[model samples]
Target: MVGIVIVSHSSKIAEGVKEVALQMAKNHPVYTAGGTADGGIGTDPVRIQEAIEAANTGDGVVVLADLGSAVMSVGLAKEMIDPALAKSVKLANAPLVEGAIAATVEASMGSPLAKVLQTAHDARNMDKVE
Candidate 1:
């Protein structure tokens, strides 16, 4: 199973996305990283790294970020992780809610990391283009 990590500016947002993913992918591994759950800033590099490491047990891990800081924090965390694991990690451009759901569905279906990211991107684009 492919592991998933949800990063957001607000911890609640991250958790909400994770919850949706979990509902869609009951058997897959899902994790969240962010700040306080009460709408505070959730961009801690250490927390993001820990979440990624925890999610990346054996299967590859997919990271979904909400905003700029969420992505930056994941990038910083990647630098702190082992090189091999870092190579398997990917950042998804999908938005918080839809991206998490699409990623989770693709990952659960045993899609490659690249494809999962693409699915998330496609899902995001569908919303904009349709």
Candidate 2:
């Protein structure tokens, strides 16, 4: 099963997104990396790296981040982790909440990494109003 990581400047936001993703797929692994070590509103590369490692389960890990800095942190975190694990981690270019939910659903179905990533990216085209 693929894993998931949610990154946000606020710990609450990251945890909230994880909560929502879990509701859709309780059996899947979803970790969060949000805020600074001191509980401030900032992204931390080390925290993101730890979350990535924790979320991974030999399959792969998908990361959804809110804001640019969070995304950058994800990149830095990837560099800090093992090369093999870094290769298995993907960063989705989709809205954090929607992407996490869609990816979780796809991964819960035993979908491969590429499919899960595609599902997350596809969420960008969702027509919420229609």
Whole-model Cα lDDT of every candidate shown, in order: 0.83, 0.94
Specify the highest-lDDT model's number.
Answer: 2
Pick by TM-score: which candidate is best? 2
> Which residue window of length 10 is worst by lDDT in model 1?
121-130
**Candidate 2, pairs of clashing residues:** none
- What are the clashing pairs of model 1? 35-42
Q: Encode model 2's per-residue lDDT on 63-122: one tens digit a residue.
A: 999999898899999999999999999999999999999999999999999999999999
Which segments of candidate 2 are over 4 A away from where they belong? Answer: none
Compute each candidate's TM-score over C-alphas.
0.89, 0.97
Which regions in candidate 1 have their CA more than 4 angstroms from the true location?
Answer: 36-39, 128-130
Candidate 2 local accuracy as lDDT?
A: 0.94
